[model samples]
Target chain A: DAGITQSPRHKVTETGTPVTLRCHQTENHRYMYWYRQDPGHGLRLIHYSYGVKDTDKGEVSDGYSVSRSKTEDFLLTLESATSSQTSVYFCAIREAGAYEQYFGPGTRLTVT
Target chain B: AQTVTQSQPEMSVQEAETVTLSCTYDTSESDYYLFWYKQPPSRQMILVIRQEAYKQQNATENRFSVNFQKAAKSFSLKISDSQLGDAAMYFCAYRSYTNAGKSTFGDGTTLTVKP
Candidate 1:
């Protein structure tokens, strides 16, 4: 198991509310990624951070934002939650020059 | 752009039998990586095996092995002596060597191992 952890393992929020999920890692890996898993779509990348204050959009970046101020913490925020955003979010970290990514326990979010 | 496809939505195998999961990908990049990840009922993602495009030989981890045909754009996972613990959703993913380690994943195949 990797030293990765996702906070708020399960959450439910009403539409149009603000919600943020946190991913913390102890490995100090340079790359951190956020993905959302949905039926028939598998896991889609939401966003990724290569280093502190450096981030990039993924295939499904809409309706989500991410920030990394430190090496160990990466945060994903849904500015205004929507029903479409209801899914399982996962956080993964990859060390530099590593081919495999270590995943954290997923966070399940529900938007009513 | 890259896309991963897992044609089988579900499969079942008797315990101690061997089963293979199919995966095909489309990529223009010559050098990349392919991976198989297993997500049990607990929903924790575990890396089953990985194959580097540059490597001609397939990669194996214990009972899990991959058949990598780079020219065919095919990567399949073979589980030998399957156990009930192998029952889970298996995902095939593709990552380019140039990208920042971002991956494109297939819809996934659910494996059912009957004891």
Candidate 2:
């Protein structure tokens, strides 16, 4: 409910194909993050952006790349999709001084 | 680095009964934040409660409350008068006071409320 939306709520791609997921926020928050949720593993951060064109890697950033050219949109790309990359991806936004993050609906990706 | 752990993978409780979910974290920092998030079958994540390590008193929201033991490094969530709607996956998370908006989350505990 924080004015966040993830494009392509669902996606299917073959292995070795390129895939990109989009996260758009209307709240104009300064911080945006990409996370993947898996069974028994919980949610793990993939990448995050603090401001326009400013980004950082997370604990599970391998095989994944992100770009934040604008303040409203942050993109997560997988150079080459793999079966291991299939999972529910969530996007979250937070204000500069806020302690909590608001999440989007999430995107389900499948690699065949 | 901070890590969160939820010892219980599953739990059950009858309607109107009280249930407590366990959570523990490893952190050396003196100040930080802890949170409980609920994810229903709809897959929407909702914030249930939050506690600031600097506060001695526990944080409560309606029928939900937290028992935070700083010295023991334990944070547990107590749900009172549990309802069927409370049946869902609960996650405990820890955030550093100085870290940029990043949080470490526990695996999760599935709570089943029997009517």
lDDT of 1 by residue, B3-113 (tens): 999999999999999999999999999999999999998989999999999999999999999999998999999999999999999999999897797899999999999
What residue runs in model 2 are displaced by over 4 Å at the alpha carbon? Answer: none
Q: Write the per-residue lDDT of candidate 2 for residues A1-112, one digit (tens) a residue.
A: 6899999999999999999999999999999999999977678999999999999999899999999999999999999999999999999999998889999999999999
List the pairs of residues colliding in candidate 1: none
Model 2 root mean square deviation, Cα atoms = 0.7
- Per-candidate iRMS values, in order, are 0.8, 0.8
Give per-model TM-scores.
0.99, 0.99
Candidate 1 Cα outliers beyond 4 Å, as residue runs:
none
lDDT of 2 by residue, B1-115 (tens): 8899999999999999999999999999998999999999888889999999999999999999999999999999999999999999999999878768688999999999999
The worst-scoring run of ten residues by lDDT in candidate 1 chain A lies at: A37-46
How much is the TM-score of the A chain of model 2?
Answer: 0.98
Colliding pairs, model 2: none
